[model samples]
Target chain A: MTRVRMDLFVSLDGYTTSDPTPDDPMGPDWGRLTAAYTATRTFRERIFGDTSGAGTTGVDDTYAAAFFEGIGSEIMGAGMFGLHTFPDDPDWKGWWGDRPPFGTPVYVLTRTAPRPSISMDGGTTFHFRNAAIGDVLAEATDAAGGQDVRVGGGIGTALEFLRADLVDDLHLMVAPIVLGRGLRLWDGVPALDRSHTVTTEVAESGTIHVTFTREQHA
Target chain B: MTRVRMDLFVSLDGYTTSDPTPDDPMGPDWGRLTAAYTATRTFRERIFGDTSGAGTTGVDDTYAAAFFEGIGSEIMGAGMFGLHTFPDDPDWKGWWGDRPPFGTPVYVLTRTAPRPSISMDGGTTFHFRNAAIGDVLAEATDAAGGQDVRVGGGIGTALEFLRADLVDDLHLMVAPIVLGRGLRLWDGVPALDRSHTVTTEVAESGTIHVTFTREQHA
Candidate 1:
């Protein structure tokens, strides 16, 4: 079964990322908001491309390593892919640069004109799609080759899949920082316990990891 | 030091409570949202008047027991005192019955006409005040007889104190439910790390106890 998974680093107040400003293309708040996750060994190796293994190998790294374990195909919003920051700049190859971290078939959800898919140095191939969550998930599943389909986010994209009940597992790392204002992730998400088995783990890094596994109902 | 303290039972998504309706005065959400808190021995005894020691005495109960410790008064919003549920009826003495809970001076922040103070069977005295958070906290601190001043909440009331940087110690229990909507407690509060030291402890009852102690600034 190709389960839909999501892993988001959110502020204590539910903000996943701050608005992108010219001074800070990735948003000045993203660093502080995602400090714990970015400090993990897996993040430094997989996401940051640091082969020196200089990151923490504690509880946080364990979860970070598990995040990319079974993921075969990735579906992300245009915002997460940096299109929201550089909508007019056609030269932007995403914030991840030439060799994107996601070594899988990536689906970028957008309503812009259909363009050719961009293949990165890694196995990552960015495919453009303009469809509802279900349709895109179906396409992502087919591209996943029976592996898990991961929903990469910028909050808005993740909520769309969650609200549609398409996500099977959600792992949210609650950082201690509180972004007073930004895009809230849990705004329209209904009481998850009604349909999911929710559990929590507190890491020594002051990050509370919350996982919501959707329950199979009769 | 008489630190201003707060202990709120909030959902995983940050909702403190739901709106009261005709059929369900406290709304259907409050019961499930407050299950962990209400099931504690301290809650069963203090809030429910259960003296049989029937409730669980776990990590949640330990925090529940500490919630009332200190020498002081309490500041609460009108909604928390049940005035919102029975706005037209002036006879409602709150949901705590005749004796009430707190054995100290209780200041209810309300915009209604100044009514005579109600001295419950217990030492609790309900004093209605139509003033800002600073003024009320000052009065509550003075009335507390040099002890701690607790800001009892239904979320909005607590946010008022937190936003003003008046609360010294905040202890929030994150319940397992995701109330899709309600009064969010962390809405306008900026990154707490800027002013407070945050720590988390997960209980056997699945409630994550988060504490934020105000840092002393020069």
Candidate 2:
């Protein structure tokens, strides 16, 4: 069976963004929050498209490699798709440029999803919908084929699926920093531990990796 | 040199107490939050006085042992001293009974502090004072001689020293569970990461131990 998985970057204090605005989306300390993950070799290759083989290896790299592995489809919110940035522009193809990182079917859940699915370079196709999260997940699950369906969060989208108890695997890349300000994750869903078997590990660079896997899926 | 150090129990969401009341002190999920620590051999020997050597050893046990070692004096809030539980009763020597946990001078910082120091059965002496935390720490430092001064927290007390940058070593025993509603520990202390060098480790039982030791002291 195909599993539903997600990976999120947060500080030790469980913050994602700091006083985020539409103009400055991720805020000032976004780099600090994602310092460890971005330092990984896999991140340098996958996200940055660096062919020079730069960035650190080992624990953080292993997790970074797993994030991009076996993911056939992705479901994200308007923010992640960059719909909020250029809502009026018909040519807005997200922040990932023409050659987007995800080489799979990407579903953008928004109230302002234009009409048709836009096919882009690098085997990527953007599907827009305003349907309920469960309905969207069903479509994404089907589109994933035998591979895993990944939830690409702006955090809000992921939490909605998480609160509904749909996510099978969740990994939190916790930076060894205290962001006393910003988005507070895990506010309402207190059964995180009860629903999943959690395993935590510390990387050499002080990044803490915490994974919660649902028993049936495991 | 005498160093100021502290160890606190918090959830992954950085919560200490949840919906706490005078009747139900630590709230409903206190037991669940402390499950791993309580399961440790050192905790069983120290806190429960279970000298039968009946408890799990290793990662959690090592941390539990360290919590009780190399500490000459302790400073805490009135709530931690059980003054809030039995305020009217003059003979109430705290919930720990006569042989309290700390075998050192335990300073109780309270506004309604009674006159004269009360010496207990053990090497423990309850010193009540309405003085500022810095002043109290000075006295505690003096009383500690060359040994470390430990700040025993009700969280609020700990944060006070933390925000003031008085603590040299801060160790957080982060339970794998996330308590959605509780006392938010790192609410205003954003500089916790900036001031100290952080290191995270995971125990076999899934309890995460994160330590923040000041670089100057290190």
Candidate 3:
């Protein structure tokens, strides 16, 4: 069975953005945080079809590359797929340009009607899954071969997996800053049972990297 | 005249929260980020009615205190006032407790029908404003005295003020992470010929602080 992992950076308060869309000022951090990936040979070759980023490195870049290299497929929430206003527009793909960073199949969870798969470069394909969480996970697993399946989170999608206890591992790079107000993680969910054990901790460049793995309950 | 300053911690890709509401794992970062405000004696006494805090006695306390002590009034967007599902609910107060952290008056920008003022202890009051941005800013300035009125941003509200060129200063603390998705700060706004001059840079244990004062355009 492929373990489900979720990896993302979260504020000290746990908001994904300042609003319901991906075009906010906070959006630029993605490029900055992922700058290391662009400086990697694997990242450039796999996603951008370029050989420019060979041998260049940083600790952040290495960590990110390792994480991305392990992922076989990605499942994202509908809000993560499109801006909140353009949720229903089939024409609008995503904020990422023609070739997205993810070089694997991307499953978008939405309540909208199903549509045909949109194929991009580097073997990446966007599959809209209107089915339940279980169905989506199963399809993504099948599409992922035997590798790990990552939940490309947007709070809503990650909560569904967390609520279902379908998530196996979690990696959060906590940035020490607060929005004071915005969308929040764990806003409407029930209190969680503390069974997960911290498996790793790495403090790097003003961010804390923490990993938690679910413990097997007898 | 009082200047309105919007302060927020956003992801690289831009998102206010991990989810629309607060129940997601990514939402916890917001709590940690806002916890910085509790570090100040004045802010702590005003918000929580106490001076003692858990592990808030060092340099962290000073930095946190400085961030919150400078703000005056707060402004937020309608979607940020509550969950999107409760758009029609007149009874939905914000996620904050009865007495919010802001000791000053708060403005909730919305097209919805304005409600009566919600007064709370510690001098925090909720006043719904449905007027134009200019009128709202003017009212907020009067309420703020000579202090900088802080726009309690939800991306949309911040972008609106940024579009109108009403914001005098912006304190954007970029977290070292990427949501890779979620609400963006400048999603639908028209481009502006604005330039930012970095006033201060502080690399702390958890995140870097970069303050930018909007430079006067030629």
Which candidate leads in lDDT? 2
TM-score for chain B considered on its own, for each of the candidates: 0.91, 0.95, 0.76
lDDT of 3 at A57: 53
lDDT by residue (B6-65, candidate 1, tens digit) is 888788888777765544544678778678888889988988779998998989889988
Highest DockQ model number: 1
Show where candidate 2 strays beyond 4 Å.
A49-53, A113-115, B48-52, B113-115
The reply for model 1, stretches above 4 Å from the true place, is: A21-25, A49-53, A86-92, B21-25, B48-52, B86-92
> Given candidate 1, what's the lDDT at residue A189?
80
Encode model 2's per-residue lDDT on B1-218: one tens digit a residue: 88899988898777987887776677888898788889988988887889999998989999888888889999998888777877887777777877988999989998894757889877999899899999999999999988999998688898898878899999888888877788988877746877888889989887889998887853
Q: Which sections of candidate 3 miss by over 4 Å?
A: A22-58, A83-98, A188-193, A215-218, B1-218
Can you rank all candidates by DockQ, best first?
Answer: 1, 2, 3
Clashes of 3: 49
- Two-chain complex of model 2, DockQ on C-alpha atoms against the true structure: 0.71
Q: What is the TM-score of each candidate against the true structure?
A: 0.91, 0.93, 0.46
Calculate the i-RMS of every candidate, to one decimal place: 1.2, 1.5, 10.8
